[model samples]
Target: MLPDQSITEELPKDRKQKRQPHSAYLRRRLMTLTSIIIVSMFALEAAVTAWYDYRAQLANLEKEAYLLADAQRSVLAAAVWNFDFDIINNAVNNLFSMPEIMQVAIRYPDGEVIASAGKLSDGAAQMRITRPLLWDQGGEKEIGTLNVVIDISQVESSMLVKLTERSVTLSATLFICLAAIYLACRWMTQPLEELTAAITRLADGDLEQRIPHTQRNDEIGNVARALVKFSENSRLLYDLQNSLTFNVAEKTRQLKQVREDSAHDNTVRARLLAMVSQEIRSPMTAIQGAVMLCKNGLTGEIQEKTLHMLHVAERNCERMQKLIEVLFDIYQIQNHSLVLTLSPVNLLKLARTQTEIWRNKAYQTSKNLHFESGVAEAWVRGDEKRLQQIIDILLSNAVRHSGKGGEISVHLRREGALISLSVSDNGPGIPKKIRPYLFEGLARSDEACSDSLGSGFSLTLAKGLVELQGGQIYFESIAKEISSNSTLPTGATFYLELPYIPAPEAAD
Candidate 1:
């Protein structure tokens, strides 16, 4: 309802809307999941192909090596039988001509090397094949052994190149798959994203937003349909709430206008009362003077009955004059026309003076009035007249509320940089229901009290005057049970606090 309060209520929604959308999360997860699956499949395929191809190549190379060794066995056998060193050398040299053959050796039947070509080193990447040479075809005649060492490093190098190519292809494939998945996810969730945006706008007070894909027959379209329904409902609800709010606001505005009119009327009445009281007081003052003279025999010798009547007329005039002054003070406070003449005044002296005046009045009412001052002289910055009025109001309330034989206490003390004054009464305390409106003009706890007499305007004027002089007034009350029969003793204490100002130091 309040501007600041409305902003506070809407701030969390604003912050939540500012966060990343669900579509972004969906897109990222889809792309990542797709890429991982594709890459894993490619890696597995590459690994299986490479392993199978390497094993097949190794088997083929072994078979070819055995064939080459068999073919060279006959030549090597005939060469060794003839004891022809040139033939053995030629055969071995021809075997070395094969690039795969790293070494070749023809040995005699007695284990003596007849001929050898190329170097033979023991390395894991080489394949070796050996075959025994036969001299007679029908009979087994041992000649020599043909040994050939083939280099497998070239095969391994070729396989490594193939694997590198596959790796490059796999990487490219993964990139393509990622791009496709991203596009696919974007297409699938695009409607949802739009719906979300529309919802966000609606939540942000844009009730006109609508989902655009409600006609499609898919899951997204189903959601869109539901969202459209929600939007319609929300719009209707918003309209209803808006209408209610407008009505309430209209009523509130009317109520405020009425209150303002009432305040204006009260102000006009106070001004009128001030004017009438002044006019009546002038004549009443003259009448009182004449009556007092008649009672004193200054005009003529008056009878006892006439003198008693004069006395009654003078007292009535005094009461009327006091009521008029109170009305004038209320008018001044209501119009904000009460001006304070601020000066350094001794609050202790002011409290003592008002206490002595109220003490006599309390005594006449059979109420005990006591004053306690913690400090001899407590200086404060305030208007003396306003301060006196505050004390008077508190004392009057205490004496009026406190029953006969009740005790009323006034305490004044200097508390740090402030002066505290309190008036307490051992009588019925303020009722809880009336505490809220206690300081309002013409508001009285006792409804039967005459408006022209104890209208509670004094306390309101006192609070206004105190605040105008940079002071505060408040009260505390406690209800205590006195006996098994009596309900409780309602007692109240009113406190006034004003800034303490020390006297100016004398110049040296």
Candidate 2:
């Protein structure tokens, strides 16, 4: 018959369908602020009222003392002139009867008591002279004197009653005013409280929650409208952001697939080229051996011209094979999937030989190719073939890019533990914008097109080969503005620094 306990616990929302009113919350907040303000005002008002009451009591006592002095002058004059003790005694008795009169005494200028009525000590005039006293006679000659001691009890009592009445009225009025302020504050803040709750829900990811805008020409109405606009804009921006993220993710996935396919193609091409090179070089090698045997005339004499032709053909064929092998090596290096063939080499000699090889090409281009070395000998521990490739690539680049009738210089120096080799040419310099990506393989710029050897592959492969041998390569190029003269042609300079090994003889 009854629902389960867990279901019942969760079912309270159905019974209390109505949400809590914003007015109730606002009323509580206003009451708290109003209570603080009322308490502060009441404290200030009480302090001021008590001060005023104390001052009024002091003034009343002063006024009464002066009136008693005037009354004493008349009564004492009549008693002395008429020689009637009854009049003087009756006047003193009346003064004593007054509640403000604590004590009264009549004294001569010489401190002699002529008459006294009320409680006082034998020498009370001297002891009780803290409050100012008045004399009956105003002149310097004091034939007789009268003194009145005014009591302040009645004035204090009356002032207390007045202050108490004022306190009750002031308290009642302040309470009423605070109550009115509390009601007004609650009314003004009710809509704002509801709007805040709605905004809170929206901030917590509930886009559907929104403040209701009531039409009225007031700040509260304007704020409600502005909030509704903000909610709409936020919803649109959220959806747009999600769509952009999805689009970017999809594009990134496609780019990854393209890279994979390109990688696969490169692998297939490399394998096919390797097979073709092997097949071609084998027959060319056999022909060269046969040609060499005929040139030697083992069986018959051969013409000198025919022998010269065979030598040229063999050399050209070898060059082509070497180019193919270099391409294959570069690809393998890029894939990080190749092992280097390491050997110790005399780097200075290697560089000299490569420079001589490029001298003819540089001459044909009308550029002077020169090689200078300060090192007597420098040994390097690295792959001889790879290191030579790096040197050849740099030389070939210098020869190809140098201006006509320009100088191309190659310098090798054994500077401390480093073997520093530099190849610089006089030509149009490399552009600054493309300099950063110059060593990156397959990175080509329009300015590089000026050179016939500008495949953008040589520097990339050279850098890799040098690094594989535990060396570094960087280049610097001077601008045309710096090298203005045609003879001093602006060009790029490639600096190669490699670790040098101690010679076997030197070590011993």
- Candidate number achieving the greatest TM-score relative to the actual structure: 2
Candidate 2, residue 176: the lDDT equals 77
TM-score of 2: 0.65
lDDT of 1 by residue, 21-96 (tens): 3454456666678678868987898978997998899899888878777776777787777887897888788778
Residue-level lDDT for 210 in candidate 1: 60
State in Å the error of residue 18, model 1. Answer: 38
Cα-based lDDT at residue 427, candidate 2: 73
Query: Candidate 1: lDDT of 273?
Result: 68
Give the distance in Å from residue 64's predicted Cα in candidate 1 to where it truly belongs.
4.0
TM-score of each: 0.63, 0.65
Model 2 weakest lDDT span, ten residues long: 124-133
Q: Cα lDDT of model 2 overall?
A: 0.71
Point out where model 1 deviates above 4 Å.
Answer: 1-62, 66-86, 89-218, 357-367, 396-406, 426-438, 441-455, 476-492, 503-508
Pairs clashing within candidate 1? 429-490
